[model samples]
Each structure stands twice: as structure tokens, then as C-alpha cells.
Target: MTPAAIIEPPAMMELHRVWKVYSVGPVKVPALSDVSFQVTKGEFVTLHGPSGAGKTTLLRLLYREEIPSEGEIQVLGLDLARARRGEVAALRRSIGVVFQDARLLPGRTVYENVAFVLRVLGTPRREITARVFEALRAVGLSARAQAYPAQLSQGEAQRAALARAIARKPLLLIADEPTGNLDEGMAAEVLDVIRDVWAGGTTVLVATHQKALARTLRRRTLTLQNGRLLKDEG
Candidate 1:
């Protein structure tokens, strides 16, 4: 018998009535409740809310790190809830993430750290070199490729993390409080790189509490409060 042709996926990322609940000692704690949103190609969006408002929970759901308790999440056309382990891994390859900390491997050089994901995903060595350098160049860290994480400045390390995320040319980029650890000026610089990534056609979703910075970016803002989506402003 002949095998069926594979169907291509539509939107890059999607969330439908998603909910996340944490069980602690017979009590249920809800982080996200019926959150529904979609991020298309080339859009820049920010999730703004105070701590414990389900911002991180929502981002985690999109990244497939945490499964929703009540609804479905489709990323790159893969149903995260129903996907096999290998399928989920493949789905994650198309998503990039930046956490509050740079989270670079301490001993590895900037280049190696940026190339780590590509190496794990079995990209060819030659292609890894080319892609790593290109990503570093995109984040303005090509000159510091050989520097260790400890040797670089905070901003430089964050930029290296950014380079790592974009090295694979992911369709969606999720950042959770990415600027939380940087100073105002350094945060702006990081935001500039994020804007560049969005301009390059990757959808961006940033979870941050910095209202001023969010306004400066002029992107759509999804405000969350008490585990609920309060406002979506464009």
C-alpha cells in the first residue's frame, strides 16, 4: 500500500481555551484559565502582567514545557497534548525561547553555546558553523564568539542566548521576562535584537511587567490578571 502525503501546517502557534492547574497537597491552584490566543508569522506581541498572573504559565504552554489541563495547544500544527515524545521534540525544534537569565553553559565559548542546540538537533558541523556565525552576527556578538560566558558582560551573555535561540531560525520566539535581569539601557539593547528577530519574520511573544518598555516597543499587549486575560491591546 502507498503511504499518504503529509499535510503542511498553517499558523505557527496557537492556543485554544487552555488551562493549567497545579495540585499541591489536595488543593488546586490555577495558573491559567481558558486562555485562548494565536501568534501568526511575523507578529510581535507582549504578555504584560504582575507576578502570579499566569503570564509564564501561558508562555510555558506555548513552548510545550507544560501541558494544559483543560484545553489544546497547537504549535506548528502539532497537537502538543496528543503528540508522541519524538513528535513533541520535533515540534520544539521550531520554537525558540529566552528566559530571564541568559542560561549559557558556563564553560563553553559563546560560539559553542550558541551552536549547542543545533548540535543536539543533529545539524551538520559545517552548517552549524555557518548558522552559528550568522546568528552571532545577527546579535552583534560575532567578535566575541570565542569568549566564555563568564568573560562576557551581562548584556553580551544575553545576546549570546538570543543568538542561540535564533540559530535554528525558529518560527516562534517565546521570551519570559527576558529583560528582567538587565539594566534599562541593556534591556533596550536586548529589545532591539528581539525587534530585529520579529522583523526577520519570526513571531515573538514576550512576557514582561515593564509597562514603559512594552509601550516603547509599540507591539500588541495582552494583559493578564488573576489567571484571566483582561485586555488585548494592539
Candidate 2:
């Protein structure tokens, strides 16, 4: 099979009165209540909030990991609530997620880690090699391509995770607490890499609890509190 050479054309996301309620045995807890908003194609946005404020849940909804108990979610022009399994898989292929923990495969080399995505989608070996190196270079991890996850500093690990996400050249990139575990200098480095990705035209949504980070990025910020959108400061 050939590599995935598809270009991204500014992906837009929409949510209309979305609600997510989780039932824990006999008690039902609402994670997100009546949330609605839209992210225009190629726009960089941030979701800022304290823990338990529904930021992660909201993101998971976009990736369709958790379906809404009510309301509607449309991502990349598909209705998530009604999207079939195959559709969801295809959607995810075009979306990249950087979790707080980095989520790198411990045993896999940095290059292989990024290449895994392409290989899974049938990208040819030569294309995978070039794309993997390209992504590593983007995040300043080219020199450590052969390093294992355990050998990396927290910062390097995070950058490697970013490289893995970018290898696919996703249309939409979502990062949660990207710099949460890093120190001042390391956090700045990671943020810079993310900013570069946004500059390259991929729609980006970043979730972080750090107010200072949000202000520093200076992108549009959506504040979430108590499962509600408290503010939309663009």
C-alpha cells in the first residue's frame, strides 16, 4: 500500500448543547452539561480549567471515546453521535492526541514510535522512514531517534510524543496538559514545538490547567468550570 499523502483542509469541529452523564452504580454524575461551541478550521484554541472541570471529557467526546448522553457533536463534517465504527477509526487517523503522560511505547525506539502510526495505516516503509525523521526533526528529537523512552528526560519524552503525533500529519491535533509535568524551561520548549505545529495549518486544541501558560500562548481560550464553559476569551 502507498503512504497516506492526503492533505488537510482546515478541519472544523462543532458541538451543540452537548451533555455527558456517567452513571456510577446507582448515582449518575454529569461530566459536561449543555456545552456548545465551534472551532473553525486551522484555528488554535485552548481549553483552560481546573481538574474535574470537564476539559478532558470534552476532548474525549471530540475523538468519540465517550459519546454524549445528549446533544450533538460534529467533527470533520461527521456527526459523531451517529458515526459508525469504521468512520470513527478513520476520523482518529486524521487526528493526533498528545496525552499528559506522553504515552510513548517504552520498548520502541523514538523513530519506530512515530513510524508505528504510518505503518498501521498501510504507509510504505520508505515513506514511513522519511516521515518519521521529518516529524522527529520538527520536535528537535532527531538526535535521540534511537533512544528508548526510559532514557529520555521528561522534556525529551514529551517532545518525542509530539513527534509521534505529527508523523501522521493530522488535520486536527489535540493535546491535554502538554506541559503539566515539566519545569519552566522544559515547558517552554514543549510549548514552542506545539506552536510550530499550529503555525503549519493544523487545527489545534490544547487543554491545560496553567493560567500562565494560556496567557503566554495568547490564543483564544475557553475556560471550563464545574462542567460549564465559564468564558470564551478570544
TM, every model: 0.93, 0.94
Winning model by lDDT? 2
Off by over 4 Å in 2: 1-11
Please give, for residues 1-234, the per-residue lDDT of candidate 1 as tens digits. 878988643576778888889999999999988888876667889999888999988888876778899988888888887899899887788888999999999989999998888999888888999999999999999999999999988888898999999999998899999899899888988999999999998989999988887788788899998788889889
How much is 222 displaced in model 2, in angstroms? Answer: 0.6
Q: State the weakest 10-residue window (summed lDDT) of model 2.
A: 6-15
- Candidate 1 matches the true fold with a TM-score of 0.93
Choose the strongest candidate by TM-score: 2
